[model samples]
Target chain A: MNSMVEMQNVIHRYSKNTIIDKVNLSIQSGEIFGLLGPSGAGKTTLVKLIAGILKPTEGTISLKGTALRHLAQMKNYGFMAQSDALYQELTAWENLDFFASIYNLSRKRRKERIRDVLEMVDLSSFKDQPVETFSGGMKRRLSLAAALVHEPELIILDEPTVGIDPVLRRSIWEELYELKEKGVTIIVTTHVMDEAEKCDRLALIKSGKVIALDTPQKLKEKVNVTSMEEVFLHYGGETK
Target chain B: MNTFHVMKRILIQFKRDKRSVALMVVAPLLVLSLMWMVLDHDDSKLELGAVDVPETMLEQLSSDTLDIETLSSSKAEGKLEEGTLDAVLYFENKEMSLLLEGSNPNAAGAIQKELQSLREDQQNMVDVEYYHGSEDLGLFDYVGPVLIGFFVFFFVFIVGGVSFLRERTQGTLERLLATPIRRSEIVFGYLAGFGLFTIVQSLIIALFSIYILEVFMDGNFLYVLIVTILLALAALSLGTLVSAFAKNEFQMIQFIPIIIVPQVFFSGLFPTEGLGTWVQIIGDIMPLTHGAEAMRGIMLRDASFADIQWEIYILLGFTALFTTLNIFALKKHRRL
Candidate 1:
């Protein structure tokens, strides 16, 4: 399998403390990958480095066989930031239209694709609604829709469903799986135990280091655990 | 820059935030219009009262200059107190008594200046006077053109700078950066976008000041338009350039007293003759000094294109320098 992203001995530090050290990770194409960790476990920092938003102090990252020296190279990969970055005064269609224009999406294509994405996020009925009027859950789904509007090959979602209802979260994951079937690489950072099981593979991270990397079944078998919570505990080095 | 994208975005924002755009453009127009009404009130031939004046001296006074209404001393005093008569003249006992108009400073200054010049001309008989402009030009008329330029530069700079800073602090800037667009394109896009509305802004202000306010349009109106548009360019560039350094709108507003008010002090709005040497030097580097000088020269003094050409060049140079510095400043946004 071709590795979509290759990280070799990446080291990142903030201030004097080391946040990540000599970490090696390879994310391949056509898979839903999850980074599972507790808060402050450096999972967000690791994904941000792979997305090329942050450069490693030591080591290199190659994407699709090209070194990520140019930040625009990473632009082809959609990134959903932690905040819902929609303009409050702008309508949903206006926000999406601006994104489409900024990505240089063609007029005809933007129109059709905006409709498709709005429908995909269940915001089609509220196209003219200003983003300020949107609920927190709705805003998260809208941000997700913006990241997927261009239909890029790779997507990096930083805490995509924090306050979302379980039913809607399940639907979003189902949509991610559908995109995976169509050959898109997805990377998600989450602390939720059940969501960790949905990924094709996961890297259990703690303190900026990946403590475990394997399929969910293999992780459970390796630790002789029946639940992801127990797997997290096993990787976290708790005797229980 | 993709001008259409930038322009469309601004137009939408204007439509949504009509209050801000209107405040920026309309507020200046309202203040200027009030200034015009207060300053441009006409002074017809003054109905002065003269008593016991020599026939020769009284005949020598031009008919166009005064009406020469002969009234009693008591009547002249009453009219002066009521502000009906502009002045009263008496040459009894070889002592001339003059009563004056006291309401507007410009009217008093004009009358004093004209009488002084007329008195000097009378002292030199059969002498040719090589006068350039009328000695009786109103003070408002003298300062009006510079005020026009000042208003445009002042309003555009504050509005654009604060709005751009708001974009940065509100996380919209980071959102924009996440897209597949270059940093320089974003800067240029803002310039072109804001530049479009400010063109209409500049035109309305210049024309209204010249035609409606009658604020002394002496030279070619087209040249006035050219200088204004160029000055707008300078202001716009300065606005975007400074926005890079400001973290919030309040910080942007703080730049006004530092960056803008000093321009007024040295921009010919105030007399700078007695200013400290370095203060005057500071004015020389400011974009407003050039813009205000060019505007005053063109609209009030009726100076030709050649006279203001150097000012135009300096304004353009200021804008270009600010834009280049702006590109350099964007390095803070991204290393590249």
Candidate 2:
């Protein structure tokens, strides 16, 4: 399978502190890839780099064989940051419509995609409600729906399920799997162990460095662990 | 086409935020109307004290417009110091000497005006020379155009700057950068979106000031709209640029004193002519100064488009420069 994203020697810094240090990783197409790390481990920064919302201080990030500097190539992916980022005063449907329109989808396509994503997030009934009235979990789902609205080949979600309930979280995971079956490449960042276990492959990041990279089963086996939590502890503690 | 999407989204958002809509449209109008009422207040009666004046002159001065009081010189000085008497007229020599309270320029101007007219009617006095503005000019006629440009620029600057800053703080701007949209497109999208309401705002305020409030409107209405709109554009661009430096809404408000107040001080609302050359240079750098100057030129002086063309270009130049800086500022978030 072709690599959907390629980060070579990516080094990102804020002021004098290095956030992403000389790291390299390749994300294959049509797989659920999880970046698991503790808080402040630069997971958000690295994901933002891949989503083309930020630039690397010392290397290159390419999406679909094209450098991110070419803005046209960025349309191939959808990005969701930790924040819901919805227009508070606008209705949920209007927010989705705005994003869909930015992608230049046909009016019919825009309506259909908006309906599909809202249903996928179980927010179809609340489409006309203003986003300010939405609960935290509802807003998170809406943010997911917006990221999925354009139906791009790649999706980058940063802590997408942080505030969601377990049942709704399971539903969202099922939807993400369904998209993966449709050949969409998903890159999700999370500190949740069970969620990390769901990814086809995991990159265990610690202090801005990816300490281990493999399938969850293989990683656990290599660490002589039964759960991803043990594998994370093994690496996080061993590094010290 | 992409710009239209951004514009549409902004308009939709505006529809939902009724308070912001009212603030942008109604606040300026309310303040301006209040200013008109104050500036266009009916001429006030003057209190005059006659100290050692002939009874004939005292009788001439005693009318509905002037209330003359007979008092000793010391008593007259005390009354003037107490702000009771507007002025005290005394005759020590053949030459006339008038002691004015001198506080409140408007009251002083009123006293001077009444005395000038009194002198004229009594003796067919020394011929008064004509100047740039006729003697019939009211304070509203002089300050209306400045306030018009000022309110538009002020409100648009605050609203545009704060909204753009919110986009940053709320993470929407980062989300926007992730899309295929160019930085310039985002900036232009905001311009087109905000630009629509700005035009409407300018039209309503200009028309009301001219037709309803009866401010001086000697030139083309179209030119007035054009100047006001350009001033708004300058404010919009400068405001967005300033927002990049501000981290939050409070920091944005802090800019009012630093950026907005200086412009008002020299926007020709007061007499900038008496200011030193270097101080006047500060006015030249302020967009409001040029905007107000152009507005006054068109409204009061009947200046044609060609006459105020330089100011229009300066305003446009300020917009272009600030917009370019804003686009460059976006590079910090996303290099492309």
Candidate 3:
């Protein structure tokens, strides 16, 4: 199967310290790939690399067989950053329409896509309300709607469910699954182990390197552990 | 096209954020109105102490402009020190001398000017005609052109810088970069978007300064609009460029003293003709210096486009340079 993303020995540094060490990753198409790590373990940096927002200092990243060094390649990337990143003063629809226009969707298509994404995120009722009045979960949903506005082939979500309640988190995961079923590749970074288990493939990263990469069952079975927390502790302890 | 999208996003945000919009448009007008009331005072009464002046000369000098009080030199000095008197006019022997409270520059200047005119009356020299301004020109008329440009530039710089800084702090800038839009497009979008609102702001301020406050406008109104708009663009580009270095909104405010205040001092609100060579050079580099000069030339000197063309090009060049730096600055966030 062709990989949706290919990072060959990527190394990214900030000043003297390396934030992402020499690492290799291949994420398959139409699969939910997870980068699991603690905060500051370089998960956001890795996703940003794949999303074409940052350049690797010592290696290359290719997205859908094209080099990820130009802005043109980012058209396929729908990035939802850790923060909501929505314009709080604008209405939810305005934020979605802004991103839709940024992606250069046609006027008619933009309206359709915006409506669809708002409905998908269950935020259509509050579409006209300013985002500053939104609760945390509502803002997150709006941000996800904005990411989905362009109907991108690849979605990169960084810690998407940090402050969300369990019910909303489950619904978001269901939406992610729906997108995956539609042949759209997804990359998610999270510190939560349960969320990591929901991904088809996982890269357990620590301190700038991926210590383990496998399916949830394989990773748990290799360590003979019943829970993802144990699997993470098993690999994270060994690396230390 | 993506640039236009960014512009639209900014305008939409402005629509919802009424406080910021009011700050940009109404704040300057309010301040200018207050300044007009204060600086355009015509009945400025002065308190004077007559020190050993002859009774006849004291009668000659006593007018509505001067409220004369006869006192000893020591008493006169004490009253002057205590702020009850603006000046002490002493006539010892045949020569005339004046002692002015030097702390208040305006009071001192008015007294010195009045003293000189009294001396000029003694010689009876014909009153010199003003080429650019009338003898009736008030301080507001003199500083109104610069104040207009300064306020527009000031409000736009703070608002624009804080707005861009918030984008980074809120992570929207990174999200924007993750799109297919180029970095230069982002800068251009801000210029065009903020440029539109600032155009309205400039029009309101220019019309109010000239028509409402009745500031002297000797040249074409179109040129005043052109100069204020260019000044706003310079401020906009500089604001965004500086925002890259600021980690938060507070740090952005800290730039005002270093970046904005110095420009005011040299922007011809006061005379910089006798300033130090290097100080004048510092003024020369400030975008507002050129802006204020051009504004003064147009509104006060009735200068044509050719006279202020150099300033126009310099302001445009500053905008371009700051914008190019902004594009390069974004490379720190995304190399591509």
Candidate 4:
């Protein structure tokens, strides 16, 4: 497998305060890579950098062995922000169609992909309903469908399951696993311990720095802990 | 192609928002009709008391728009004081003395104009000819073009600005930037979407004002539409560019006093020529000033397209400048 994204000594600052500090990581293709940290740990910033929505103050980020520069390179990834960035006045089908068209998909392909993504998110029946009438979970599902409508190679989800219930969260995780099986690289940011456990690999981040990185089993065994929370606490305390 | 998609989504959003459509199209006509009602009326006759005035002079003053009554000097003074008479006229020692009830400036000004015209008529009766509008034109006719331009600019500013601001607050703007779409595409897309609606809006307003309300239209109706559409486009671009600085809907409303009201003062609602050069220069920089000017030129002065082409260029310039600034403003969300 090849590395989908690589960050080298990446440092980001907003005025005098550093948001991302000397971060280095490699995300493998066809893997569910998770960035686990408490809030304000620069997880969102790091993903935004990798998504090329932001420019790092120092250091470089490369995707698919090439530097992220041209806008055409943005076609490789799909981003689902913490906020469900769906147009409330538009129907679910219209929203998906819009996102797909911005990716320059043909009319027929956009219709087909909109159907597929809606089906994948189990929102096929709600396609014609306005998003304003959707529940929080349904809006989240539609947001995920928008991100996947174009069949992007890399999918970056920032706290995708925050307001979702356990049953729906399980289904979303299952969908993520299904996408990974199709060789789609997935980068997920989460603060939930169990959600972190579902990732193929985990990077424990604290105070703008990654403290530990490995699979969930290896991270637990190396820290001599049974729970992912203890492994996070051990790594976090060690960093302190 | 990406721009077309953005434009399509906006049209879809607009289709769902019927109230906004009504506000943009119908509100202007309602306000204009109200204005016409308030400004267009036949002149009221003033009540005048005459004492010891010659019969020939009294006949001259008694032509129209005045009610003359013969009374003693004391009785005339009493009538003027009691407010029953707008003015009291008498001659003493071959000189005329006038006593006026001065509480209402409009009434006082009307009496004064009657007296001044009487003096002028005594000297030599001059026939007045209009170069543009006739003497029958009311205040509504004079200001109607400016008000039309104002309504278009004002509604487009609020609606377009608030809608674009919603994108930022709702996070759809960030989502849009994350796509491979160019920033110029977003700006142009908004222009095209809102531009189409403004064309319809301009047509409806121009027709209603010219034919329905009957506010002194002389030039071709198409020129009025063209000027209004350009003005709305200028407002749309400026509103979106200004929205970049606003954080929410309330803040967008706060811009009304700063951005929208001042333009009304400069939009030829009042005469800017008597104002200082610097003040006129300030009016010159505002988009509505040129819009109102071009609108008045077309509707009142019967100006041809070539006659108002300078204003047309200035309005186009404003739209282009604000649109480019808006494209730059999107850089705050995504550097690309």
Candidate 5:
């Protein structure tokens, strides 16, 4: 598979403190790549770096063999922030319509895409309701719909299912799998070990460093552990 | 094209928020009406007691602003002490001794002004002619234009600043940055979006003051609209730029004392002439100062566009400067 994203010695600093130390990764196309780490483990920062929302203080990042210097590079991916990020005062359709328009989709295409995403998220009935009236899970789903409205080739989700119920989480995962099958690159950041196992390849991050990078099954077999949590502990122990 | 979308989103959000629309258009009219009731009243006539005054002098003192009463010296002194008379003029041996109720300074000053004008009338008999405003022009008329600029600046600053701050705090700004939209597009979107409402707001407030409240307007209505719209644009851009430094809505409000109140002090509500040069220089930099100057020139002096063009340019400059700064400020969120 071709590498969809390649990071070389990416170091990000905020003022005097470094948040993302030198890290390197090559994410393959048509795969669900999971970034598994505990909270504040620089997972969000890493995804943001890849998404081109932030510039690294040192080193380089490139997407599709081109340097991530152009603003047009943002068109390649859809980002769902950890926060729902939906406009509370606007209805679900308005929110998705806004996101779609910003990506410069034509009015006709925007209408069609917005409907498709809303239906995919099972929020078709709630399309006219303002997001302020939505429950936590509903808002989350709407946020996902907003990200998908533009039909980007690469999807970057920062903890897409943090507070979601099991049934909804399963449905979202099923959606991710469908996107993967359609040759889309999905980058997901989650601390949940069970969720990490769902990705085609996993990068176990701890304290801003990648402890291990491999398929979940391979990492488990290498560590001689049946549970992904034990595999994480084994990898985490070796780094210490 | 992206800017149009952002503008549309803001208009939709504003439609959903009805209270903010009311606050922008109605609150200013309410405050202005209260000011008109207080400051636009006819001048109060002073109660003057004249004792042993000649008929000629009595007739001279007998003007509309004074209620002259002939009385004995003792009775006049008693009236003055009781605060029933503002002052008593005691004319004896061809000299005058004045007894005054000195407790309230405003009343005392009015009495003194009546006497001073009477003395001037005797010396020169000068006919007073107003070059711009009439003698009938009330305090509300003198300050009305400045208040119009002030209300527009204040409300636009608050609503625009708080809304932009909400975008940041709510994380929508971050989501917006992740899109392919340019940073300048976002800033321009806010300008155009908030700008439409400011245009409507300025029109309503200016028309209400000129037609309903009947504050003395001497210039073209279009000029007044132009000045107010530019001032509101300045406020909108400055508010968004200031929002970048603020962490929350409360912090955005904290800027009022630091940003809005000082502008009011310098906005020609009170004269800044006697103030130190540095103070006037600070006033010169404030957008409201330029706005108020242009507004006053247009509404009171019947100034042509060329007359207030310097103020117009300064106001436009402030808007441009603030807008550029706002574009730069978004770099803190996402560098493009």
Candidate 6:
């Protein structure tokens, strides 16, 4: 598989301590790459660096062999934050509408994309409701819908399913798989073993460093573990 | 383009937060209305009870503010104790003793001011008339223009500061920074967003104070609205710029006394004419001072817009300067 994104020798610090420590990684095109780590393990910080929200303390991140600083690559990426980042005061449709404008989609395309994303999230019935009234699961799903509203080829989601129910989570995963089949590369950060199991490739990270990288089955087999949880435990060193 | 999105979110957020919405529109109007009623004097008579007043003192105490009745010494004491009379006076020749009910400060102040003004009138101090107008100026008349400036400064300072602070704390600010949207657009967007409301607010406050409350508008109505609105914009910009330094709403409110009160002191309600030269100079630096001066000039002095053009320019200058700082302030979120 060809690389769609790469982080080369990235180092980011928070005053006294480093959050992402000289890490180097590359993600293949059209695959769901999972960053598995506990909370405070720099998952959101790392994703923020990739999204160009922060300039890495040292080194660079590029998308499709082109630096994200270039207009084309920046436009081709969709980023979903760990927080919902939804304007609770606005209706679900309004939230999507406002974000869609930033992407510069034509009116016709924006409307259709909004309809598609709302339907995909199973929130079309409540599209006119204010997001402040949405349940935590609905808000998370709405955030995901906003990320996909622009239909970019590369999507980055930071802890996208934190408060989602299993049934809805499964549906969201199905949608992710469908997007992957259509050659959309995805990066998701999660500490949940079941969610990590869904990614085509997994990177086990600890204390701002990636400890292992392989396919879910391959990594588990390589670590002589039956479950993704045990494989992460093995790599994260929860055993003697 | 994305600035519109941020602005729309701001307006919607304000609408959703009913407490602030009420504060923005309702609170100022409520206080102003209270001030109007409190300041307006109807020249109504108060029942005065006198106990054994010498005939000479009774004649001197006869004024429109009082309807005096001589009571037996015991009856006068009873009336005073029962609150049947506002005051009970006892006089024996030139030695008079006055007893006043003092539970409410306003009632007490009214009695004292009336007595003082009557005494001055009797003593003949050029009748002490105001050069521009009569002494009939009411509570709203004295405080109306200053209150207008204060409301605009106060609410804009609060709403603008807190909302911008929220943007930072909520992480949406980081998301917006990640976009290609420029910093000036963010500042401009806030100006437009809050500007929309200030226009309506200024119009309402100006109309109510001048036309409804009859707070004395000697100058053009349009000039009054213009100065008030411009002040609101400057306050909004200054507030948004200050928000960059504040981490939360509490810190945002800390700016009120430091930022808003000093402006009021210099804005002319208090006598700053005799203040130390540099002390009075501090008032010149605040946008509210120029605004209040213009408002007072227009409403009280009947001055034209040209007479206050420099004031307008000074206010506009503050708006622009603070707006520049607001844009630059966004650098705290993103280096660019």
Which residue pairs show backbone clashes in model 4?
Answer: none
Q: Comparing to the true complex, what docking class would candidate 5 get?
A: high
lDDT of 6 by residue, B1-336 (tens): 767766776677667788887788778888888887877758567767788877776787678877889888788777777877777777767666767866656656766676667666655666365877467776568678888878877887888788878777876677666555677877888888888878888888777777877886666888888888899999888888888888788998898888888888888888788889899779899898888888888878888768899999999999999898778777656555
Every candidate's lDDT? 0.80, 0.91, 0.91, 0.93, 0.92, 0.82
Pairs of colliding residues, candidate 1: none
Error of 1 at B205 (Å): 1.5
lDDT of 2 by residue, A2-104 (tens): 9999999999989999999988999999999999999999999999989888788899988888888788887899999899898898999999999898888
Ranking by TM-score: 4, 2, 5, 3, 6, 1
lDDT of residue A65 for candidate 4: 95
Q: Tell me what TM-score chain B of candidate 2 gets against the true chain B.
A: 0.90
- The regions of model 1 sitting more than 4 angstroms off are A13-20, A37-45, A205-207, A216-240, B1-4, B37-136, B273-277
Candidate 1 lDDT by residue in tens digits, A129-229: 98889999888888888888888899988888898899899888888888899899999999998999999999998888889999999999998989999
| Backbone clashes in model 6, listed as residue pairs | B39-B139, B218-B299, B218-B302
- TM-score for each predicted model, relative to the true structure: 0.81, 0.94, 0.94, 0.95, 0.94, 0.88
DockQ-best of 1 and 2:
2
TM-score of 4: 0.95
Q: Which candidate do you rate higher for lDDT, 4 or 5?
A: 4
Give the TM-score (vs. native) of candidate 3.
0.94
lDDT of 4 by residue, B35-71 (tens): 9888987777899888899998888778689989999
Segments of candidate 5 deviating more than 4 angstroms: A237-240, B47-63, B67-95, B119-124
In order of listing, the candidates' clash counts read 0, 0, 0, 0, 0, 3
lDDT of 4 at B61: 79
User: Could you give candidate 3's per-residue lDDT for residues A120-168 as a string of tens digits?
Assistant: 9999899999998999999998888888888889999999999999999
lDDT of 3 by residue, B15-53 (tens): 888999999999999999999999988967888898889
Task: Write out the backbone clash pairs for model 5.
Answer: none
Q: Top model by lDDT, which number?
A: 4
**Candidate 2: where is the Cα deviation over 4 Å?**
A238-240, B71-82, B90-113, B116-135
> What docking grade applies to model 3?
high
Badly placed stretches (over 4 Å) of model 3 are B49-59, B69-83, B87-123
Interface RMSD of each: 2.2, 0.9, 0.9, 0.6, 0.7, 2.5
**TM-score, chain B, each candidate:** 0.76, 0.90, 0.90, 0.93, 0.91, 0.82
